[model samples]
Target: MTARSTQNKRKRFDPVLLLVLLLIVFLTGLLVQVILATDYLGSGLGDDVARFQDLSGVESPVTAVLLNFRGYDTLLEVMVLLMAVVGVWSLTRAPFPKKPIEPGPIQLAVVRLLAPLMVLFSFYLVWQGSHLAGGAFQGGAVLGGACVLMLVSELPWLKNISSRFLRIGLLSGPLVFLGVAILCIVLQGTLLDYPQEWVGTLLLLIETACAVSIGLTLACLFAGGRPKDDLSGGRKR
Candidate 1:
């Protein structure tokens, strides 16, 4: 039986198929690298990597590539976030049954002390993301973790997080991505291809919106309850 189970698991993985896929991916990567190295993408975006070249403190070419050259990937990333919100919402639909599980006082106290700080930290990450490494996804996940902690404590105040806001927060990034893409087409004759005049401002604007929406949507999901119409029993303070 043990040998049979091991063989079944091995069959499921199909190492030969995985190796073939890996080989294909490697070949594709090699092709892209060669293309970029040859300046086939124009001027080697890496030229802008230096602080002297990007005096405004951003790696302009990198930002441009993300929002323009590789914009399809960014759009798909936004879509993934949208789907996550939709999936979670569908999974925890109406008639939210109370599971009768209450946190112990000790746990509740810990949550009360920790949740707000975590949320604040998430905002910090969002705010610093423009020129720094962190961004909306990282910050939002942190905020969501805080919301889950608060929800676990069954605190009513925390439960009053607005449902309308939740929906907006969940959809904001994708909406902005779509909006910007459309605007770029209107202005530049190509989708997501921002005008050179507006590149810096546009990147900042999109990043901010993505951060806030990511934070709010994820937090709402973590909170689990439908965004409140009334906090009858969930009041925080």
Candidate 2:
């Protein structure tokens, strides 16, 4: 009976289950530790940002921080996004619908009307970033949504869009950003240190370029991979 009971215990043992339980316990303890260490009353960098907002050139403190004070971080973020899309493209081809469904007239009309308005609104958001809450990411999101709408509507032009143009759009933001940084180094002996007179202009340029790239990036991600035209050397498969 003793031997039989030991054999049953061995049969019931699961290393994977034990590991999962241990992981859950470890995570719970870490969460508790984080809770204990929380400082709810700690003041953040809002005051410092406001103190130097004028020097930063943009009317919006958030824009000043993102495009000016912490520009390096923003640069890395854009590169990361580009790398993500590149990685996705390398791993898989875009799985566009094989049987192209004829979109209804109403759907087509809605998309045609909305797409142009969205494009206009996206730039408007970019323009607002300097003085208001909207910025590149928000504008880019709107633009991406517009692309998605057109794609779903099966716009013929989108199917034939050249990979070359896509590549240019994807690279525009980071290239412009890095170019500006290099130019700043030449002019001011520091990376991204814009001349006072050029600060506003430089910020707008960066925002515009970044918005375009970001929109393309998001749209490409939604498409899930490289276009079929790119894979087939610009010929329809």
lDDT of each: 0.66, 0.89
In model 1, residue pairs whose N, Cα or C atoms come closer than 3 Å (at least 3 residues apart or on different chains), thus clashing, are 156-234, 156-235, 157-234, 157-235, 157-236
Question: TM-score of every model?
Answer: 0.62, 0.87
**Stretches of candidate 1 above 4 Å error?**
1-57, 60-69, 94-113, 158-162, 220-237
Candidate 2's residue-wise lDDT over 25-100, tens digit each? Answer: 9999999999999987776888899999999989998889999999999999999999999998777778777667
RMSD of each: 7.8, 4.5
lDDT score, candidate 2, position 50: 91
- Report how far off residue 134 is in candidate 1 (Å): 1.3
Relative to the true structure, candidate 1 has a C-alpha RMSD (angstroms) of: 7.8
List model 1 lDDT by residue over 34-138, tens digit each: 977784656554665453334332444444455555767888887887787676655553223345356788998898789889988987876565556565667
